[model samples]
Target: MKNLTDKEFEQVIFENQLLILKICSIYCESQADKDDLFQEIMINLWKGLRSYRGESKLSTWIYRVGLNTAISGFKKRKRSPFIQTEELPEHSIDPKLQANQNEEVKILYHAISMLKPIDKAIALLYLEERKYDEIAEIIGISEKNVSVRIVRLKKKLEQIITKQLGG
Candidate 1:
């Protein structure tokens, strides 16, 4: 049928998978957590698409819905039972910089982990190269707010990183 179950929906999902995956990777604490977050995003998008009128660009709607999915997903994951290290994936990084790469990424993610959910979304989207307007639109905040939050978030991230580095 030309309704909820169709190809166009899949197209939208496939097209946006990278954005969804990136958001999950940035927000989630671990690989299994990331996968759960991604699923939550997809389910929300699928559920929300039915009511998407033409008032907004499809990309805009996707951004909004996806961002909300991530925010709520992060919250749920926080309250739920989480996996221990044994549940983590064993994906390998580059051997040349393996030592430093994993440590730096873990540190970076740990720093990001400390942000409030909304600020986490803002910082993650900022890191994903979204324009200020797009970030604001996705976040339901003003452009100026996006900028301010980012500056504050950067300082917070710096503090976290500094502490992690034992400074």
Candidate 2:
């Protein structure tokens, strides 16, 4: 595996920054922690670039690196604080639906925050709409396992959201 040139590295980061940030958000409660995780992920990506054989899609490679860093950092930190909900990126939302959607997003993230580290990584990749095969590759799980986990994760998330909503 060849190392990415500086230009190539910057381009890769430009293309995938949001994906990295989302992974960080899954493992981090505070904005400061998220920022720290993001930086760690970037550093790992730079250091690991030479080893990135093209066995998987580039996005899959990025997911693999991002998730491993997040999970490892989470274990090392052993953070137990509650999720600190952040506002979603600005987008045109119907005024009538904004409040409901915002609350739902917050609840959803809170539910996600309660997940174990691997489950959080799985949930993030699943929510990103990755194909089951791609998710299996990124997570290093069997495709069948990815399918089963998604089903169970959905149920778990539903239960968590319902409990949070007092339903």
Best by TM-score: 2
Per-residue lDDT of candidate 2, residues 40-148 (tens digit)? 7998899988888888888899899888888765556545475443454344224465356587788999999999888998899889999999999888889999999
Can you write out model 1's per-residue Cα lDDT over 82-160, one digit (the tens) per residue? 7332343445223465356676677888888777778878888787787889888888879998899888888888888
**Root-mean-square deviation (CA) per prediction:** 4.8, 6.0
Q: Number of backbone collisions per candidate, in order?
A: 0, 0
What TM-score against the true fold does each predicted structure earn? 0.72, 0.81
Angstrom error of the Cα, residue 165, model 1: value is 5.2
